[model samples]
Target: MRIVLWSTAIVVLVVLVGVVYEQVGRYRAARDFPAPGKMVDIGGRKIQLDCRGSGSPTVVFEAGLSVDGSLSWSAVQSKVAAHTRACSYSRAGLMWSDASDAPYSARQVAQDLHEALTRAGEHGPFVLVGQSLGGLYATSFTKYFGAEVAGLVLVDPSHPDQVARVAAFMTETRSLRSRIAVWLAWSGLLRAAAPSLLPQAPNQTARDSQAVHAFAPKSMVTQLVESDATDASLAEAGAFRNLGNRPLVVLTSMAPYTEAELRGMKITPEQGKQVQAIWEKLHEDMATWSSRSTHRLLPNAGHDIQFDDPAAVIDAVMSVVETVRADRDNGSH
Candidate 1:
């Protein structure tokens, strides 16, 4: 009985220490790294939006799942901004954005973005550049607000049917891992290990992204929420099949999964190859969504094309922007 009581007390003390550590870490992070952009109120909640440059059609960036919000576009946003108005924003519960009790779905995310842009006076004709899961959200945005969207750039985007098609990707173990990540984040263990866990890229943008992710405790929770709603989000995005004559650029990464990645997914090399084949096919199908679409395969790039090759992404965006500009000038848009 005494041993049980002592064990309980020790656990309680450890938890208290963890909570205090998290609080202190959070305070220091907030002090050191303030929001780098305007916090525009979207009704009850506020979202951080960083806009730069100036031109007719604004370029908006949508980040991937479990990323550092607007900071994910740090490498390419400024370069794109130089030619046209480019903006990146944090979704609710990520980075500097306020969290919401409401469920996180693609539609809700699209609505939040629309409200944010409108309230911030960042009007469109807009070109949306989405990376990974962000591509689905961009598709959802176009499904609802097609008129404002002039073009789209999907960088190794997630396919709507990936969960069903990629057997190695949607496993019970993967779901369990996501749940474990949330617990780690809540316990502040994730923050402690974040520096070592994230990629040790040499650039300042990478370091800043790492810092923001390490400090954001709710980021994991938000990621899990988004993961849970993946099916619904995919369905919502998949509903939009056609983009008419709107310029579209689908960049597919040809990098194969590494041996370690295959081991983690518990799939054989043959199975991994099959998965890649299906992925490429899906991108090809996505290219058919627009009459003026250009599907480019990057041999040296990976899923995070924005990071793997920012110049490729910039070129894609510029190409789409130029196409939109030409259409506008010809009064054919």
Candidate 2:
């Protein structure tokens, strides 16, 4: 009787405490997150831009999925901004960019970005740098917004059509299983029992998300996670569903995990070969994609080439800058 009541009260108290903790964690995650930098009104939408540096053939970085604005472009933005007015922006509904009723497609994003560049008085043939999902946007710019682009550097770019051909093997095996495992690990029961600890070192000294964006390069894993550009229920399908014609540099992840990654993904060797062959074809298509497209491999790069290898990205953009300068000079004649 008395003992049962005490135990019941204790259980209720524990549940209440857990609820409070979970809410606190969520609130912190939301609050600690920083708004993107420098809002520019482009085509009636509030777009965030980090436009630093100076000079022409302005180097622009289009971020991978989920990331927008300064944080999205951190890795390569500053390095390029040092030499030219490099622009990195948050797409609509991402980070600090205005949420739109519009679908998140390559074309729509490109149009919005076009407006931003125009509003900033940025002119055509700018060097484009994009990683993962951003590759779709960059490629679309070449096909649809050719007037503004000069050349492109695709850092581990994603292709719309070949996606099914790309990760299908992994999806068929370990990836799905790992995803399920993570789901279980982060489930309500586990989260309730999990210790209250900060993701980084726990001092309650919350990291300055803004400073992280204002400074430092993006993380390779974060970049990799930004691969899905669309919010579609189907996952892989998104706007700018194809890479029509864009100068590209496809940096592949050589992290050594295979179809036997962690889940049920048991991709066959033939499947691995197929994925490689698809990339080779994408490389070959680059010639058709641009008048002068280069495919350079980053030996130790992951999906987020910019984040993992900023110097390589810097080198690529510098190369484009040189070309843009030469072309402008030649055109002036």
Candidate 3:
């Protein structure tokens, strides 16, 4: 009995040590890397906004759900910055940004972004680039501050109806997955193995990847709140109508899913086709939101068109910027 207790204690001690080591690693990574850009205060909390290049109108990039906003756009931003002033920012509770209060609804998230840009002195009229879930927030921003927006680019954006539609399809499976992910993240197990779990670039060294992974965990509290608020966020964003003929470019990816992805997401080929049909329809509707809108589909790219083919995104953004600038130059818009 005593031997068993001693063994159990040893195992517990090892596990506890591992947890502490991971927590410390994460803390150190965040402290050492520092925010690439200055943290602008949005009320009590702070948001990190990384801006590059010079020339207007300023272009702002918003990331997909649960992604490192600034890092995700590192490659694209650098390229776009060469031609025009481009900025990418972490929403509250993401990356180097501090956590904000509850109810991260679409409207609130948009407000947070507007406030961040204003506080950072990033003057507009601005061109906005949004990816995946970032699409909702981007649209909401335009709705609230339409006059400030000059152009829009959406990269394989998530339709506001997606969460509800997908939820109805795989509620239980998604709920289970979300629970497991959140629990693991909260327990620090995810952070402990983050180096392996996080994405690595072809040119990035292992240490660079580790540093990025260490600081990228989305806090479970924030994740849970965001998940719970999804429907409301969609509803709020859906209320907005018309884009005032803003120059809009929607880039879509038509990459076929691999067997692994299909199985992992619990989607069959038929369901995938159905989803794609709905997705394309939504994109078509979004194009109609503006008279000066175009939708392009890339057969080879995946959902992350920015990463899969940064050139495509860059081209689309530059096109929109040029159009907007021309309008401004001619005093037409």
Candidate 4:
């Protein structure tokens, strides 16, 4: 019996080692992906930034949770840049940036972005293009620094209402708290298991390949993994849901993949399809919640609509850019 117990212990140790090894492998092999551009020091973090092109109302790209970073914008960045100033940046702790800071919140993230823009010499009258989690940041900009924003883009972003919606799944807020505890614990274990990985690249790459890959070019995947921006972005999901208006262009997907996005959440694909149907009804309700907003439904897109359909994203982006230009010309007058 003692021998059997010893063998079991040995087996457990071996299994643990394997898990550690696999995670480390993910960290190292992740290097095979993209690398971030130059770093812009923002507060204590060195944020990665890519700025190109020249025109009025600089177009800025904000990637969502675990995004393709510069890659996500790759499809539309240069095109917009050709007519204006285009910028793409990686938030702290994601890929190219360091992971020295503690966990960050939405306000903290927006501030970091603001500082990064300042340090990078990126002025306002900004046209913000953000995807998924990045959408939260973009919207938060509306909540925090609404005047500075010229235009906004929300690419199938996380809705705070979803959190409240998911609340029905549990017995009460207590269970929700418990689930949060379990989730944090599990994420902590995973992070502890993969120290060698660059700050936030691995997760971002997976997000693009899995859900948001529709429009993300293969190159942007590199910066997404190495940049630590994903964590900061997720931390601010709450603030975005509370966002007011500053001219937002929300691009939603037609194809429902709630089963895929909510593979973890209690939501289902059918339910997501229902939401898509509601968003499609925007033409009917535009006078209400979305006044200055222009809603475009992509035809062959999935949850990551911007990617599944680049044209749709390009259309939204161009629309925002045009508004930015119109605002600029109007300002001159």
Q: CA lDDT, every prediction?
A: 0.84, 0.59, 0.79, 0.59
Q: List RMSD in Å for every model shown.
A: 1.9, 6.7, 2.5, 7.4
Question: Residue 49's C-alpha lDDT in candidate 2?
Answer: 75
In terms of lDDT, model 3 sits at 0.79
Each candidate's clash count: 0, 13, 0, 21
- All candidates in order of TM-score, best leading: 1, 3, 2, 4
TM-score preference between candidates 3 and 4, better one:
3
Q: Model 3 over residues 296-320: C-alpha lDDT tens digits? A: 9888787878778888999999999
Over 126-209, each residue of candidate 4 has an lDDT whose tens digit, in order, gives 888877667767767666876777777778765544434444442222235433423432223323423232232222345434
Candidate 2, after superposition: displacement of residue 280 in Å? 3.9
Query: What C-alpha lDDT, on a 0 to 100 scale, does residue 270 get in candidate 2?
Result: 65
Q: In model 3, which residue pairs have backbone atoms overlapping below 3 Å? A: none
- Candidate 1 residue-wise lDDT, 1-333, digit = tens: 999999999999998888888888788777878887799998888999999999978999999886488888888999999999999998898888888887778888999999999999999999999988899899889988999999999989988877788864535444675578677675677677666556543233655866665555766677768877877888778888788889999999888887876787778888877888898999999999889999999988867788788899999999999999999999998
Decide which is better by lDDT, 1 or 3: 1
Q: lDDT of model 3 at residue 83?
A: 95
Q: Which of the numbered candidates is closest to the native, going by highest lDDT?
A: 1
| lDDT tens readout by residue for model 2, 1-333 | 999999999988876776665456445544766454477787677777767878887887887664334465565677788888788887675555666667456667778888887787777667787776676677666667776677788777665555455656555332554344334332233333223311222111233333332211222123223333343312332343343343445555554334543333356666665665676576455434554667776557655566567787788778867877876798731
* Structural similarity to truth (TM-score) of each candidate: 0.94, 0.68, 0.90, 0.67
